[model samples]
Target: MYTPPAFRIDDRQRLVATIRDAGLATLVTATVEGLMATPLPLLLDETEGPHGTLYGHLARANPQGRLPAIGGEALAMFSGPDAYVTPAFYATKQETGRVVPTWNYVAVHAYGTLELFDDPDRLLNLVRRLTERHEASRPMPWSVADAPEDFIRAQLRGIVGLRLQISRIEGKCKASQNRPAADREGVAAGLAASDRPADREMAALVAAAPP
Candidate 1:
């Protein structure tokens, strides 16, 4: 994450919020064979460690769980709202024709050591927690207990649990913070009018950015 000072997000609470909101993360590890990455929906336990702890599961067939990670460190990347910022959206471009296209986005990178386990009890609990988190907002929420016990137990056997004890976190929010106030306002307006949900989400972030 090559973040300039203007775009850096160092607030611990904000970083944790971003991670939790992003929901999905790319888990990357440097293995002896090569680098391996898996996209997963992870749960962040902020009280579990200094930075936090990430919990997820990998398919039993996924080799990433079996590989020896380099230095025992892994990186989990979470990407939030993002949108393409066209030059047409920059007021400076019209004034001086000096501005070009850019991207506005938010992201967080968590570094931690890899911990893999297959204990049935722990895996079951992890699945239940993850399920509850995602289903909490639904009108008709579902639960692990809704399924048959033998079936759920068998399903858990096909996955391996992953735990990352986070050591550090890096966050970046490139929401036109480097642009002039007028240009940033233009960007926010442009994004707000766009049809893409991602664009609309970024519009709010751009509007909230410091001038």
Candidate 2:
């Protein structure tokens, strides 16, 4: 991520919050064939390591799990709220006519060593945690125990679990922080007025961020 100094997000707590909110991530790996990527809902085990561990599973036949060993590193991307900031939304652009369209968003890039299918128990635990995290949004939440043991074990056989011990994390928060206060406020108002839910959510994030 090419992040300017003003747009860099160095706060660990804020970066973690953005990652958690993203829920899903893109995992990329290089191979002899080429680069392979998978968009997956991952379980972030913040308690496990120095920067914490990332857990996820892919189908046993998925190519990524079979490829990463050829390469030593992998990257996981977590994206938060984002919106298009139009020039019309900036007060400075209206006044000086110098501003151009840009995007306002938050994203985290995690680089780590690949630890694929380390242990069966650890894999099961990862699944449990991921299920609980997503189920938290439901009225009547479900659990891994809800399924029969044989069925659960059978299902697990078709997937390969993974662990990525994150060595580096880069966070970028491009939320109009480089703009003048007045222009930022104008952009926020414009995003808030949009019918799209994502734009409205991004507006709130920008409004809450420090100037």
Point to the candidate with the largest lDDT: 1
Q: Please, what is the whole-model Cα lDDT of each candidate in the order they appear?
A: 0.95, 0.86
Which tens-of-lDDT digit does each residue in 3-106 have in candidate 2? 88888989989888888989899999888879889999877778977887888999888988777655588889999888999999888976899988898888
lDDT of 2 at 169: 94
Model 1 alpha-carbon miss at residue 138, Å = 1.0
Query: Residue 195 error for model 2, in Å?
Result: 1.8
Global Cα lDDT for candidate 1:
0.95
lDDT of 1 by residue, 1-211 (tens): 8999999998998998999899899999999989999999999998898998999999999999899789999999999999999999988988999988999999999999999999999999999999999999999999999999999999999999999999989999999998899999999999999999999999999999996
Pairs with backbone N, CA or C atoms under 3 Å apart (clashes), candidate 2? none
Candidate 1 has a TM-score of 0.98
Model 2 earns a TM-score of 0.94
Top candidate, metric TM-score: 1
TM-score of each: 0.98, 0.94
- Cα displacement (Å) at residue 113, model 1: 0.6
